[model samples]
Target chain A: MASGILLIPGPIVISENVQKALGTPSVSHTSPEFVDLFASTLQKTRQLFQAGESAQPLIVAGSGTLGWDMAASNLIEPGAKVLVLSTGFFSDSFAECLQTYGAHVDKLTAPLGGVVPLSDIRKTLGGQKYEMIVITHVDTSTAVLSDVKSISEVVKNVSPDTLITVDGVCSIGCEEFAFDAWGIDYALSASQKAIGCPPGLSISVLSSRAIEVALNRKSQSSFFASFKKWIPIMQNYEQSKAAYFATPAVQLVNALNVSIGEILEQGLEARIAKHHATSDWFKNKLRTEKGLKLVSSNQRVSAHGLTAVYVKKPAEAISALKKKGIIIAGGIHKDIKGEYIRVGHMGESACNDSLCHIQLCYEALSELEL
Target chain B: MASGILLIPGPIVISENVQKALGTPSVSHTSPEFVDLFASTLQKTRQLFQAGESAQPLIVAGSGTLGWDMAASNLIEPGAKVLVLSTGFFSDSFAECLQTYGAHVDKLTAPLGGVVPLSDIRKTLGGQKYEMIVITHVDTSTAVLSDVKSISEVVKNVSPDTLITVDGVCSIGCEEFAFDAWGIDYALSASQKAIGCPPGLSISVLSSRAIEVALNRKSQSSFFASFKKWIPIMQNYEQSKAAYFATPAVQLVNALNVSIGEILEQGLEARIAKHHATSDWFKNKLRTEKGLKLVSSNQRVSAHGLTAVYVKKPAEAISALKKKGIIIAGGIHKDIKGEYIRVGHMGESACNDSLCHIQLCYEALSELEL
Candidate 1:
């Protein structure tokens, strides 16, 4: 039934190899073959974040939102101060998640279609003794890309002891991330989006420091996402040993293994550049040729994975594109809920030149007169 | 790599149709087509549980363990007393999850390879007023089955106000369940077990009373598994309206849609009966013909979904069966973990006569000296 070209921000088009892996017949999660695959996939997940051997990667069965919960539950104890750099709906939700775990949250929201300024972050960090600072690398709602590297630098300089976390749900596979080099304590993403797999696995990478902090936490508040429970299991899996806390989503892990292999095969730098190039090409076409306004304020801050443009009639444009067999998403940011349409150019759409998915979307939009 | 007759207690062999569904191409979670499919799948999930219209079914992207987190985080507030009827590892883990969420858990563990008696449950209920009583319908580790109807009746008679919850992760599709008739307040399962789908989706059904209790919680503790956030979204999706809290695993949901349809097509009664027949046949062959002892003390309390049996050396038997192209699980009950093996007989292996998977497993086990 999902016949059309899917262009959603996440749950983007999956590759053929990934789909085949998804259909793999029942394999015991504890089997040697699965263990080897899972081990390799965990290592590859580190590579996706540009992380080193010291960094630990976790692939659990949940959406990207679960990553936020994991970070909140494992890292932030009650009454701990956390600064959230809010770019859009996702960042706000991340703040809400921290608050849910009893973290004292201070949100620094950017203007509509822009990121929170580095100066504002520095000032906020200076004002408080925070346990952690969260930055969304790319907020899907606004298609706004925050500069994680710069923000991490600010956190390191202004509040050296604070843990720097990144919500890379929409950025990890399609954008530049150097987990070790950038001094990021933790970052999380999903299997879909730029990873080109179906949505299920919540992928994340944590520096050794983050893991140590989690290990030494005074109180533990989670079970499924508990670092105490999962850390050893992940370590054992990385060593190709069978260890079970809860049952892993076997097929999704297999699919992720295949997808991450493809990503590594293409190389992350080239893949990220391809997404940027495609984003530039499509955004140029929409702005200059089609006379459209983007939800992202400028190319400097725009995300490479998706384009959120303010259309005259967002719903009508989406319907028209749907009729032409090109599926796109409508606005999700509360302020611009019905004001724009989002077209994802990540995964196969951006990486596979022969697919021409972005061109198809552009042509469909040309027909819509939006 | 998974080539064999997979006989693990859960993550059992999936059917061809379910595998095909799992490999479905990318689809937007918010698309009309996916929404409609999801709506139908939700209804089918209700049917899978034999639940009434007043019940709400939630299919989230996680393992069955997340269901315990959801139930604990949403229904049990801090300091609330909960009685966990522990049959084995899974039930003990469920109690841990409740305790993690700040619930005051009182565990009543049964003997090895046996279920907690209804009389014990009744006495426990009479001793203290509990906010909820947790039961594992079938503990995969021990292959012990708890009579949910009788247990629920006992709870109803002793403590009518207490919520009755069932962890049916290893039981649902292959075992008899009458949600309304059994007066089950909440029941949770995973797709990989009896449902014949790849592992990813955490499926749960909650009665109106359970929903009310969840909604009425004084303080919410979770962000990802929160009932408050998911309730409206589920309601909207069930009505074929697009609503988003967190992204759904589109492919997993599609596979579940098809699997549940097949489960309903065969009829729950027939499907469940087939599992019982298969279990009886296999257990009889193991006990009488093969001269092996089962972990389950008697046939009455043995689970129909899987068989846990004692062997001279479980690891050797598992390896010997593996050499003959059959995959059986090593025991996981903490006490007899090394002495026995577990053979899953659910879904296609149990219900589809054409598969002959159970027979293959029997023949393979017969070859083993253990």
Candidate 2:
């Protein structure tokens, strides 16, 4: 009964209306009701990506990690070399996924608490035989936002043929971006993050070029990962026909539909701006407080999601906070786990005040006498 | 709101209690409430599999088709030959998926509405090399259940080393089977089917040997499809921890938890018996009325699921029925769309009296002069 503030990054707290939408009477997956649901959800996802007529948005049933696999499988062919600009934990996973898909992945590694080195990637692209470039924007693990825009510019200048993709799982609605204007070929995010839906669906928006490559990539993409299966399903999706495959997670889709409705109705610009303001306020609060330090020392910080604050006896502080019904997350990735704690500022938690959660962490840690 | 019987195949209608469970106020995926929800749902799933003391169930976030990928990726190595006994639409999809996972697949194909020739599969096994075998019990696309017991017996005798896996997506709680007793290494089903939740989470039970294979075959299984990732995460899941590696579709998990409660309380045996009775009653009505003929003439019909009826102007009959507020379904993978209509009899619809649905269908079709 005592559900405290979800100040850890995604899956952030979902709204009450969204939760009510999920409880809507269970419907057949193939029933006319679900097609309308899928259609509406798909359209909302496309709007988030700013996808034009040439692009298509795909909703696959899985976690955000699966989105990386879907992107790798569709865009890259066996033996193709890809450049993975690793800013944090997520890009590392994306690199491993690329390797699994038979791509020779080259990682341009950056420190966990730092940004992608655009110049270094440019040099690598200048000399390498890579066919694709992948960037992770706002790696949820370390709270580091990569410079996807700068990296894209450099990569396009050096290797124009390279596919430009971003693992935007931790960013999206919370972050400001122009997908079409920036020429992003593929952008992937999950419902759990700034989208404010409980996780289970990974949404991917693909440019015309990415679709062309997917269609041309010799063999069919892994069946579950295939956009082709969803393409016609969405095209013919009307109230009367049965869904093409098995029924989808109808309740989750409904939750997403409601969340997206709130997002667009309020306007994305206002939402993203509010997230930045809330993050700025939350970070300022953490900064003014005693005993906590920002992991990323530079002013250039992740604008719209979680923040990492280094603390002494970090595990004890997290444990004590959990005991008080205010659960903050521990640092992720092999690089930063023991030294810092994460405070999520995304979705409902982003706009709503989590001052009590931040205050609870401080008070609990003080009791530990650390 | 005239909510008639949802006498359609999966995703069948879930109980009102289960549907209402989705209203349990949304929580962040990493919220303690959600972790407890996931852990509880999983325990219930394990009870269903009766996955002995040593075996485990890996709950995945995706369609049941993803199950074929999970089974193949974990068991079949690159170039690992596998045998598929294809009976219907889903079986072929499994074979195709195995092929994607780098297996040399040989299929013993059965005609539509038919089960594979067990003798032919034994013959194929004796001549071929395989690491695993794929079989489907009660193909949703055909309303036909293959003889899993007979097939497993033949595989055990002729090819003991090969793992036998069953796709019980349409059969799980609707019929009875012992994963261990039948020599099955893996059994997979979707929550949207007999378990009667909604679509998108896939539930699979692994034999102890299967888990060992999964752990040992890390070199082969794609990361997303690996049971290793699933095991540690689930093992650590508890009532108090926030489980947030990926977004988990929290509300759906809650709905499934509620569905599982109803299932266990209702008793698995009772549920399956209800399905059997309803399917029998429905089939009898179709046969005696001369309004339609069974498309699946095989003696071994799926005991507790659907009855695909052959009727003139099947599409018109289905459309007409839809207009009359009594919704049903049609046959799949038969190379033609309108020759047959599949009337589902599982989950909430399993206990349904066929008299009303039949009468309504007759009225609707007669009005259309079909």
Candidate 3:
């Protein structure tokens, strides 16, 4: 608790309970107790995505980058046609990930800080015989929230056989994602960003349709990404044993249980509204300062997560802030690198506690002589 | 320290220092301090691997299971011939892994509880062309240690172009490995096992030749398993700005560093011999018991780790042991399920210190009347 607050997008403010969970002694992944923890985490993870009956969850060993790979490799095999709806850098990376696995990736791009239109997605899908469609729920780099539900609708109407997947790495726990209702076959996420757990493992919620595709795959398309092993393990532990795979990062999983509990107990709708209000409050403070602007428009912007803004003398601004223990992320996207700064209001301590620091950041910015 | 002892193979034991490290608290992975810690761990890991300029240690998120995918997907493309040396459960998993990635896998299998013969491997390689060879260095299930030096020597004589990959999950920290000396293209292990840390991230060492083969492949791998993404990230991080992709499981990384320091300071050779002595002593004690015998041979065994014993009721034996707070792992491999029990003597308690509860276990087994 004495450590400085993490104001950056991810690996953000872990709660005291979450921190304590890390101190819990390690346990074997194959052990019944560990399986219980893993299964419990999965059950809760499904709740976050609002997954349906057939929505099986899988845990992979890496960053959200692994999620991009799972979506591409498991569903979009070589020569498979896929469409990626891009909002910013993350979407571009997801598309690149698809291409890496030999998927014919078609990017439906909008302007640098804008969301892709559903009509654009339909047009892209109409022209291509795509087997999978991927939409970024919220691209972290741009802080833009795409109309993924509408896009999924458009894809389903245009290409009925196409499997809809959402790159919800930054959105799932912080934003709204109804996987089944949105016709999402798979929704992928990581715990570091909004889930308030330290990063290491990647998580995915697979709809029954996605499970079918995995079951029918040409036999274990991936050793690490295989749902076959996880599914049986998950099933076998239905009553008592809860985890599948080797020992999980037990401490992180335990912490995630706490973070998720706190959020739900406080209520998801309240959390979402608080995030939106905080995003506005941060921008309001920034607007009072000279020559600073929010990159994302309110219409298609991320809520319950972040508000990225542009500022001149960026390096100096970033360094000055970090020197004070108020660290912010530097923009790395081609369009905004060195030209913008982002404030992450996503995790445990990201609400009322950060307001004081947000004011200090504004004061710090105004004091700077450009 | 108040927690009960872990007699399981992996997730074995955590020292007070490692526990303090895990409890040290979380930090932003991108922060300068964290980068310093991350880089420090990298340097320490390289020293542990005994890797030279031509080799580098790469880390990935997830368990040891993820290592097989990283090695195979990066090195083998479609129809890449692979020779798999199977000594036990974990070794055989490699063949399944290679075949999943479109490799023509030819497995050289030994008996369920025996080491693979060097001649069998040479004969398999002589009749066909294999681009790579997969060897599990120490399989905990069977407590069998493959003669890696002999296997690599035969591999070199028979097929010079073949890449030898060793799954060093249970051996790297407990036993010994020489990357450049053994001509091993890749060596994979997880933190939970002999390395003595929480289970989540993987520590794998890859050679320049392996990286070259990965780079030369026409089909680029998906993001998670792509060595290209990792090679650059790991190939040089002492000075690179981009040190980590995901928010690392910080506390666990700290725990790993502490465990490594303890292992290095104590000396691996000395520690391994201690493990051997303890296992030998435990087996001697168990042999004196009325109904217990080791499943693995005295000569072809893992000295730096656990000793699995075949029994009439393995689960009952383990369950009874756990009742006395003397835990041991139940056999999970299909061939030996419900027939063998494993007691690990690795990590923090790799000596007689780990045997404090051995007599207690014997007492429980004797009183159970089974």
Candidate 4:
């Protein structure tokens, strides 16, 4: 096991109980106990997304990228047009994933460290009909937060048929999201990130309409990611029935269940508040005390889970922080790839005031001359 | 953690070391420590597959089903004719997966608990040229092992250009396999089963020829499973360089590394021999002492990892074993779905004699009047 505080966007610091859950002995996926646990986990996933009873949750054995593939394969058939709100590297990748599945992609590039304006999205939607609209809730590459609720509202007004999809890989657990109220058709995240679990399972929640769109698609191009193949299996598991389409990541699912339980037990509203407060403090310290420019442009648009800061020498700063037992990430955004560094303050690290993970990271980073 | 012994085909008993590895602290995928460890794990995977240095191993975050997607998306172009040797349910699923990617699949299904005839395969190859041929090394549904080496030899003789692929989901670690010697182009497996790791990673080793086919394919329809995107990332990782296509399952990979190390430490030949011995003893007891028929046609074709025995009441037998704190699986083969029960005797359970997992399972089944 690699040590030191992991301050990357993800796979972030996992809590002790979640870690213990990950190491659980192997169990039959079909066993009644596992089925019940799985059912609860799926329901917990729905809660994590703040989704209602009509929504369906899918927890598959894959990274967050598989979620992109699922959306591409299930929602967009060949010749379909998709509008991608590109915040940074991850959004660009999602667009690429869609193209791979034969979707005609139109990208609305956000300004560096900023989100695509709602006006621009509405204008684009008015000009052309899109099968889907993708929004990166918080792009890890830039730490830029998109206003998903506003974006969905714009899409709903301009093109009611356009399915609103949120790439919540970075935002889901820590950020405030209301699936029903926000009118999100589909959203996806991973186990790692703010969920505080190992990086294996791709957790997605789909609106009933989105599920219907997936089910009624003309052709399913991919089998493993095909929603048609997975929906019934997920429905079966959620109903505490044994069903198998593909073997699930049982241990990872167990870990996710534990982490989601902890997330809910602490309460989502309080957890989101803690993350926001942590982000505010850390960003304030970086801007005022350290005199550093953040990549998110402004506090209002910045993601609460993480922050990207411009560094004079990112590699040197990273190495220096490593010496202090702090692990941070270098830049990944293509336009400013080598110009900044990122620090994550979410999950147990941000929620638990006693851990002082954010404080430790700030202190270590302050020591860096870069 | 769901307790009791897990005797299912995949997601079998994970060793203590492997479980400990699974709970490892969060690590950056790009960190030197993790990169080096991942590179080492990839090398160990090559050894596990018994492949030459020319072969490449992919350890992606997914279930064994994702392996089929990889093969379908990477190797088979749309409208390409592919031959699927159907041993049981898994083979049929593999065929379905290939067809989902627009492949024209020709399934050569064997009789219940039987292997496809070599002469029939030769005749099929002689009748039409195929782009690929898929063989299920061990169809978990029936516990019937295919003669991969012999089949690969026949493919080489009849249609040298046809890529030979093996589904080693239930066979990899426990069964005797020689990637290079058998002239197999691609072989895919899972972290669970004989690997004795958690059920998350989809592991595959591809020959240079298979890589060429993937890279030179006309158009890639799938993004997550596409080798075009993964190959470069895998190459960079193998060279101990940081390159990201998607976030890896860090903890699962760590556990897989530990498990692979254990497998190598035990020696593949001895491990295979041990599984064979265990399977022979258990199967003989079922047939001779208990007077029960096996789903497998004969001893020669039975898989070493698991056994499927025909029982009067599979559900009753399974419930009875569950009561004794031993978990086994009911048959899944479509034809004899509920007539037989499966007991996995692979990994630590079968290899570690002192555990007597197989003996306990046998005794539990013996106690069942059904």
Clashing pairs in 3: A29-A247, A35-A242, A35-A243, A39-A242, A61-B61, A61-B62
TM-score of chain A of 2: 0.92
Give the lowest summed-lDDT range of ten residues in model 3 chain A.
Answer: A238-247
Cα deviation of B322, candidate 3, in Å: 1.4
Backbone clashes (count) for model 3 = 6
Residue B227, model 2: lDDT of 76
What candidate 1 gets wrong by more than 4 Å, as runs, is: none
Ranking of all predicted structures according to TM-score, beginning with the best and ending with the worst: 4, 1, 3, 2
lDDT value, residue A330 of candidate 4:
94
**The TM-score obtained for chain B of candidate 1 when compared with the true chain B:** 0.98
| TM-scores, all models, native as reference | 0.99, 0.93, 0.94, 0.99
* Candidate 1 C-alpha lDDT tens digits along A222-308: 887888888899999988899998889999898898998998999899989999999999999999999999998988899999999
Question: In terms of lDDT, which candidate is stronger, 3 or 4?
Answer: 4
The sequence of per-residue lDDT tens digits that candidate 4 reaches over residues A53-153 is 89999999999999999999998788799999999999999999999999999999999988888899999999999999999999999999999988888
Model 2 deviation from native, Cα RMSD in Å: 3.0
A275-331 in candidate 3: lDDT tens per residue?
667666677767664646777765455445877888887778778877777777878
lDDT of 2 by residue, A1-370 (tens): 2357666787677788887776665565666667777778888887887777677777777878888878777788877899888877778888988887778888888875787566788789999778888888887777777777787888779888899998888889888766777789999988888888877887888888888888767765366776656655555663245457545677778888999888888788888888888777666766675645677655585546888878776788777777777667887778667888887777776655544454454556556644
Q: Relative to the true structure, how large is the alpha-carbon lDDT of every model?
A: 0.90, 0.74, 0.75, 0.92
Residue pairs with clashing backbones, model 1: none
